[model samples]
Target: MKLHVIVPLCVLFTLTLTQQTPSRDKCVCELTHSEKAFPHDRLSTVEDDASKCNGNITPQKTVELENLLLGLEKRLPQLQQDVSVLEREDDGQLSSVLSLLVVENELLEIKQLINRLNITMLGYQRLTTNTTKELVDLTAEMQELETYDTMQVVKRQNDNRRLRRDLDHCRNGHQPTTQPTEPPHGNCPHGQFQNISGPRVYTAGEYPGSYKYGAWGRDPKPGAGKKSWYWIVFLTSSNKFSNYVRLYSSLSSLIVGVSTPGNVLIHSSNPTTNTVQGPNVVLYGDALYYNCYNRDAVCRFDLSSKAVTTLQLPKGTRFNSKGNFCHLDECYLFTDLDLATDESGVWVIYTTTQDFGNLVLSKVEEPLTLGQTWRTSVYKQGVTNTFMACGVLYATRYVNKVTEEIFYSFDTTTGVEKFNLGISINKMSPNIYALNYSPVDQMLHAYCDSYMVSYKVLFS
Candidate 1:
């Protein structure tokens, strides 16, 4: 009986062991922890519950996991939308980069164009500079040539005049005088101006260079007991204006400081209105003619009556230092209106805006009327002084400190202009501020830097 019971017990024990053993060696849930895991069968409800209880998770952890799953579920569509937007932005970014590259290429082209323009401008500027220098040189050369041509013409004219004079003398059966003969008194029977002698008389008078601007000469028309009288008008007010004119019975009296009795006063006050304005003062026929102060007009101060008369100039006349006589070195201030006397009558030499700073001459008639006006082509500023003789206007220019050339002439009788008259004047001083021709003595009276100089006029 013992052996049978032992054998039965052993068999039961083996059966029990076989029943407790699993079907597979490992479970699907166990393999799920690895990356190589595969899905197989679902866990039973009781096992799922037991596995969750064995996971050591609390109630808070379960709620958190549920919220995480719900949040992921809600954000899945937004994530997909973000991916689409990023894909679109990639294409837009590529297009923007292409545009930037195009802009950079255009900028490089513009920079090259600007550099080319700068080079072109520099070339033009250099060309202009060279051209300007060449033009200046050519102008100077042309002026020199013109001067030479003028000298030739003047020499021919002199020869022709001399021949004419000799022929006349031969026809009249009289020997031609070796020297030119002086014309009769109050008669201009001689021919055109041929030459001018050097200053026959030069003296500073009583002033002795005390005044830089003034006019001194014998009057073309004198009253009784004033035939040999010489008058001087000193610009004592800042060397620009004057009011009194002093008279001397003779040039010797003027040199000896002998004051004559008829010292005319233009105005009692110095430099007042209607007083003498400039150094170009002229004493003609017992009257003083000068530029009216601060006006484009002429003022005539009568000595006998102590009366004043004014004659307005033409429209657009340049005065008050606007149209001054100028040379290469300097200009004479307030020489705009030049009052000159010839054998005919008193005349005015001025410039008008319509004539472009050229000379405009007009005859000043009796009773202060503007007579016939003559326009000249010569520039006023180029002349140093002008005078009238035999109804012809002669203009002088600066040559040297000791010489002045009379190179231009305008004939009112024939309306002819001659630019080749090369008569020269020898100067004791540098500048001649006031130059006037006297029909009475047939001389050129020049007020040159405070010196009164007279030149003998030689006619053919």
Candidate 2:
């Protein structure tokens, strides 16, 4: 009688064991442990286990994720019901309790996931008790992973780098490499931006001068991580030497720097001037580049050198008094007469001849020094265009040539054929003047007498 009972129990146990479970948590745990101990592809045994567990975990896990999302959706209904209850009760304590419960529920759910992940692998899914709410967020998960051990370090590092790169890419949308220069064969070093929400971030209103100062430059230093503020730099017109007579002597080009959200523009105290008119300004390699001699020559203003050095141009170079030329990797010059120099290293785009009634986009082999050079056409455009992100030259036009709101985009690298970005803005009617870019928001700020118009380019 005793033998018979024992045999039946043993058979039942064997049957239960035979029905294997595909445990995602178990697979992750086992796989990660193996990865730490050995290389990845050597995961034959682990793969076999995963294959065996496939009927149980992988697809199941996906279903679980879906269910979790569903649960989150369902949670809203429950919250609405609670909100109804709280609306009836005037007691602040009871209302607070309901809100706390909702938050606590989410915390508990997250904790369960972390607990499961802790037993398995997939690394960053689990966090410690000491970790703050911000630290556990998907956005902050990369930073939190610094506490990982050596075995998991490489995996974490790669994950972090990938996340950082992606974040930067998303934040820097629609911006071009460098500013637009001579079109054909001219190069602008492309830059990718990322969105990094740091702990010390000061919002639009929180940062003092930010509302008034406009945009600034971010620090690209190694460990600036979260504590860096982009310095917003602008020039104040001193109006000390504006007479047409001193065009040869001094023009007050006030260099102003300010910290964002602060209205106080940091002064040199004693305003300064350049020998010639300072038309445009650019920051590169700890130096400022601008047009001197009324935008005829490129002048380098070095913080270290403390003086402006004039770059010798090829003979017979001139700058338009009414217009400004942008920077390419090499630099560029613009004039009305169609002059493009492959050897001259500068390209000329004439608004009259190239576009006629429309806008002209042309590239002269941007003349650096006049020699045997070439000239080419980029776009014979109908819309007025300006340099935005990535030297991705953008163009805009009015439907009847009467509206103040302008719509813009680029179709090709050369003359504007089809570069419509599909984003229309209410802000600008270009006077073909005051079209400048602020690096802070990567916006082309078109300032009129009383207002400035800004447009956003979405380039991921």
Candidate 3:
């Protein structure tokens, strides 16, 4: 319960560009896992037998119905009935808008519990047990509606005592500036963290460059110094073809041609384009967003009009090769090992067909197919293991070294943990093959398979 070493800030220029050993000492990391033991229900039965994804729900049945509803702890009587309906609202300054409308009604009940996990992954195994007790009652009602955002500083100190006489007339017209606040665009200087923490395989953020090179996505231009980079990676080592889109060069391992427009066609009842295969890819900045595989809809590649347009999907996937677009504005987040159907609940493979694998998040306007949005069904929703800070988004179901259990986080703006990082994933055993996030240096880069390690998150 003690490990916070961290020291990797330029550490003499990262010991002259990587040789390994990225820790100088700060103290606050507790990872241990070894002597062999990393089963997560045997990696959810080997990703549900190499996922053809039929009736998804793995991560060992969402970590055994989230440890049988956290050992039947029943999230404090539904967070005391949402603090008694937020003390019957209407008290002034909205009493914190009734805990932000119970955190936006627990984000539409985690999108109706991701639409009841797509009817429990298409009724596979004939879902019942009251639909796995409604996925442990919607993850204990989205972690008691995001622990009421820790009472938002008691409503900003009750608006700082009614703005203490308009903050002493704006602090007697205070004026003394010389320019210095430019570090929050993509927010680097180690600041702009929404919230974070990982008991094992490290994670930390709040200022020092918000992580960029050590790890994190969207970075591929620039070469050397300040590492501003943009975005480009093409690691399809798992092997499966048919143009998923590729490009790289955070400076250079090579691989670069840069073309555009490829996958996006969920079965087009009106536009049709679904003719994709496997190996897919998607990125934003330097432009690259995938959908190919049997195309359930998602296309747009104008790296200077190489040409190709067909992005749209409001409801198309029980078979469209499941979802894509992990997370970010234009919407579109899909996952389909075969049938982890998503957007928010719906599972129906009975008697226990636990092959459920679905994840959906859509929103398309023109030529870019797919319309109407809102999704959730997480049938083993490990949408690329996920992690996004500040605008808030995390998802590390269970890491290891010592222990981990982040079911996911999202409400009070965003979150994704699935089990909550209290750790004890069946008695830990470290081997964090890889983990990343650096917003330039926001920290959270652990990799023990080849060793690099890091941490320091004090996120609220």
Top lDDT hit = 1
lDDT of 2: 0.35
Query: Which scores greater on lDDT, model 1 or model 3?
Result: 1
Q: In candidate 2, what residue range of length 10 has the lowest lDDT sum?
A: 245-254
Q: Compose the digit string of candidate 3's lDDT tens values, residues 115-171.
A: 444554555455545446655655565454444545466568878988997887788
lDDT of each: 0.76, 0.35, 0.36
Prediction RMSDs, each to the true structure: 48.7, 28.1, 30.2
lDDT tens per residue, model 2, 1-460: 9999999999999988877755556433443353233334434544554454344433224333333343344444545655665566647786778766655554454454344434433432332222334334432543444334456777878899999999999878867676522222123332331111111111221232222212222222212221223222332333111111000000000011112233222123323333323222333333433444343454455544555565543334444433322222211222122221111122223343323323333332222232232222333233333433443334444343223223343323443433333444343222322234433344444322212233332323
Q: If scored against the real structure, what TM-score would every candidate get? A: 0.59, 0.32, 0.20
lDDT for each residue of candidate 1 in 258-346, tens digit (9 for 90 to 100): 46564778888877889988888788888999999888999999988989999999989988899999999999888889998877778
After superposing candidate 1 on the true structure, give the runs of residues whose Cα lies further than 4 Å from its correct spot.
1-188
Scored against the true structure, residue 438 in model 2 reaches a CA lDDT of: 37
Best first by TM-score, ranked: 1, 2, 3
Best by TM-score: 1
Q: How many backbone clashes does every candidate have?
A: 0, 47, 127
The better candidate by lDDT, 2 or 3, is 3
Q: What's the C-alpha lDDT at position 75 in model 2?
A: 41
Q: Runs in model 3 with CA error above 4 Å?
A: 1-217, 220-289, 293-354, 358-378, 381-385, 388-418, 422-440, 443-460
